[model samples]
Target: MQQQTSNQATRRGPLAGVKVLEFAGIGPGPFCGMLLADMGAEVILLERAGGTFASQLFGGGRKAVANRGKQSLCIDLKHPDSKALVNRLIGQVDVLIEGYRPGVMERLGFGPADCLAVNPRLVYGRMTGWGQHGPLAQRAGHDANYAAISGALDTGRRHGGAPWAPPTLVGDMGGGGLLLAWGIACALFEAQRSGQGQVIDAAMCEGAALLAHGLFNLNAIGAWDGRCALDTSAPFYDVYPCADGEWLTVCPLEPQFYAAFVERLGLAGDPDFAGQQYDTARWPAQKARLTELFGTRERAYWLEVFADTDDCVWPVLSMDEAPQHPHNRARDSFVEVAGIVQPAPAPKLSRTPGQVQGEPPLQGEHSRAQLLALGLSPAEVDGLAAAGVIRCAG
Candidate 1:
């Protein structure tokens, strides 16, 4: 286990020795980079000159939260000088992550073939909505569109109603970014044994479908017809509105937990409630009874009722309230960087703890410094800058 870092530490992090280069893009690419950086990897973000719209979302200058913990290099890939510089960098990096349509990197002359040719040990990660060679590989897509095709969106809504649009959590973060990160980590581990690297094709559709594995298994077992039926299994497993109209969640599914939950609500002694524990025929009535009881109290009252108990009940906190919640405060789940409050690095290790080294850089903020670190001379850096191959924030 790695030692955890105190909030006061300001030097190297656990992933300090790892080097990664990220091609600037939206959704999963930046997210994956952020995850690596949070874990202490030295992430360098390569952006195109004249600024990309994606760069602006994270404060193009050295001030964005998403871009935090990374150095930035701006380059004009079409220029021969820029191409050479990038190739040189690729030769030295351990991992390379990109999110672009298939063939785009090849068109830019930095595809996996070219990148691996320069460095066979480079773990190349590619993120896309479809995949590297699927029939829909060339098509454009967003979070919703990808989820729709993956059967994830289909399993989200209630049975009789139209399919509901799930929060971007499933397709973007879960399927897209997390899958890319997992693939990169696996490839890196394999590289240790094989002394070689490989390309990781992380597609959102496939990842989203993978996330629905349990549901698929249930369907196969004939225990589930679709999304809604399973979602309404128990009064404690769903959301209920309080007297103040705010929602609270309960998930006491285990028999013991369910018994405690019912007892706390003053419904434990009823034989009807006891007999209907697993009765699908009694769901409607059970739901109505629970709803009526919950509706009689305010959210705060319910919170007090479940306080210090294992009833598995909690209020649905708003975004602003979440960080201030007791558990989050105790765990330091959020951090302030450059005046921006955002989530902290997760799955903390006892040793090799992660840290946010610095805020995101402006476009090309570290072009000169990074190039210099790569062994380029001052004159060479200037020449490339003059040739319009690279830009420096200073």
Candidate 2:
């Protein structure tokens, strides 16, 4: 194997040597960059001279978990000299990620074709809610809008309730960011042999639809009514509030697991709970019974009640409680960086484990260092800072 370069030496994952130029954006775009950086990619964030709204709004920049593990260089993309500088940097990087409306990057002179001309092997990843070309491509939207249009959000709520989903997990992170990351990785692998790059047009709406394939399959086969077994319709597969207002997730889907759960709850012999699972006619009454019974005790009590069995029940831990859980602690699933607690890199690689490269960076924290490393002299970098072309933090 080729020896690791000085730049790659500080990093410790499979993508250590791979360089990424991420044009900073909100939502899925930054998330995609974060995932790549966590996997050891040397990501350089290209931000506006002052910084983005999210950079300032979230944790005063430090709490922006998505921007972690990356260096930052603040620049005015609209500056007369910015185009040439960015093109030069493009020639030296392996991938470019941008999340903008359809014509935004093209107007900025850094579209896929523009960047590919600078580096033929560059993998250009585009993240958006509607997609590159479509009737709604130019329309404004957010995570929920994308997921709602994709049909994923429609299947998420309880029957007769408004369709809802977690803020960004469905459309932004899982669908948009993750799909783009996977596409870039695949493109990178293909580039190794074909010696050519390709464009990945990852739309959050399309991604959200893709993520709901299983749900779609069920719907197609009529196996899913709006109030199916797993959609908060079944008493055994839903969250219940305890006496102390804490929550417990009860997902005893299988017969054996359900039997174990009811037995622990002292409902093993109840005529009301004796029917087999999926008896929808009995679900409402069963749920009412379970709700009343569970509300009689504390969440901790129920946790201890089924602690030793395979009841498939667990406490619905809040964000504060999750990190302190025994399983998360045992696996080091979360890590603290620069006083901020966030998730560590995932899908443990036995030979080349991923890691959080560093804390989230301030807007222009790395402007001078990054510019100097990009082959610009200190004098040039300082001149740019003085000219208002870039911002350099002390």
Candidate 3:
């Protein structure tokens, strides 16, 4: 891969010279691509000739934040010529990411075996909900199903009621995309030393289980009951509503922090509140007192009261409000590109800063250009386009 310098001082990121091929898919795959692209990798997104419906919805026509910093190529994998073109590009790519149920890539002839044959140093990343092999692997499943099997969903339920869907964050982003990205990075690091590549099977179930490692340890130590409400320590972590009905999250786990929290809440003078911070027998009463005190003031008032204190209190900001928060704004955590508001590149590097290069491409936007860049002649590119193997964007 060739290193390309960006015009701005802050645009040349750590992964500037890396070349990645993203087999365009929904959810986790695009997210992983976005992460890599944010860090300055040259990512080429390979879409099918007709384009998947997901591409139309999420891959904003020249404006998708997730699709930023990537070029698109449309090809029919079923065609031998298209496969040959992909194989040729594979030889030049450092990493390949795909999110498909077990055998889909194999059927398309772009499986790890075929990719590694083309480039021995290619890091092939596979992301799926149930994984590559299992009784449920071939079965239809989504983020919820995978989290359910991994024991994460059960932990989110209150007391004995039905499990609450804790959004798709746990399964899709944390488990699927982040895990696959980590695996690819690790594999790339190892490939540098070994001079060979390997396949990364990043299953959502496995990643979800990994996320619950701390809880699992607590369970093993008899310090935790999976029952949500029964765990007195959990009340401290719960979100409470204020007088205005807005929510505030309070989490003061340390003894000193708890004492400070009690002091800040005017509960320090109560004898009943003393030495009851960790006592399960007193949690219900403590929680009740806290709730009652919290109800006396609006969320904004309480936020002001705890502004300079160590009570570990914070207002629960909504998604739209989060980007505008003082802290987020100060950190430059969000950016607006092409009229779309989204999160900025994360994990800041002092010397090499990341950036969102450009908007997502329209379907098959770079098919001809990418093929020509790969050293294919115009006649050959025209022949492939005529045979319905490749489509170029106008």
Cα deviation in Å at residue 134, candidate 3?
A: 2.2
Global CA lDDT computed for model 1? 0.82
Q: Write the number of the candidate with greater lDDT, choosing between 2 and 3.
A: 2
**Which of the two candidates, 1 or 3, achieves a greater TM-score against the reference?**
1
Q: Model 2 over residues 235-305: C-alpha lDDT tens digits? A: 98888999999999899999889888888888888988887877888888999999999999999898889
Candidate 1 lDDT over 1-394, as tens digits, reads 1122233124356666778999988877888998888887888999887776665554666456567788888888888667888998999899999999999999999999999999999999999999999789999988888888998888776555676565666787789999898898889889989999899999998888899899778778887763224655556588899999998988888889888998998888775587746776667778888888899989999999999999899999987888789898888888877666778887787877777777767788889989998899999999989878888886
Clashing pairs in 3: none
For model 1, the superposed segments whose C-alpha errors exceed 4 Å read 1-14, 56-63, 226-230, 270-274
RMSD of each: 3.1, 3.4, 3.6
TM-score of 2: 0.96
Clashes of 2: 0
Can you write out model 3's per-residue Cα lDDT over 239-336, one digit (the tens) per residue? 78899989998888777888888787777888768775666677667778778888888999989988988778899998788889988888888877
TM-score of 1: 0.92
lDDT of model 2, residue 355 = 84
Candidate 2: misplaced stretches above 4 Å? 1-9
Error of 3 at 258 (Å): 1.2
Which parts of model 3 are misplaced by more than 4 Å? Answer: 1-11, 56-59, 159-161, 226-233
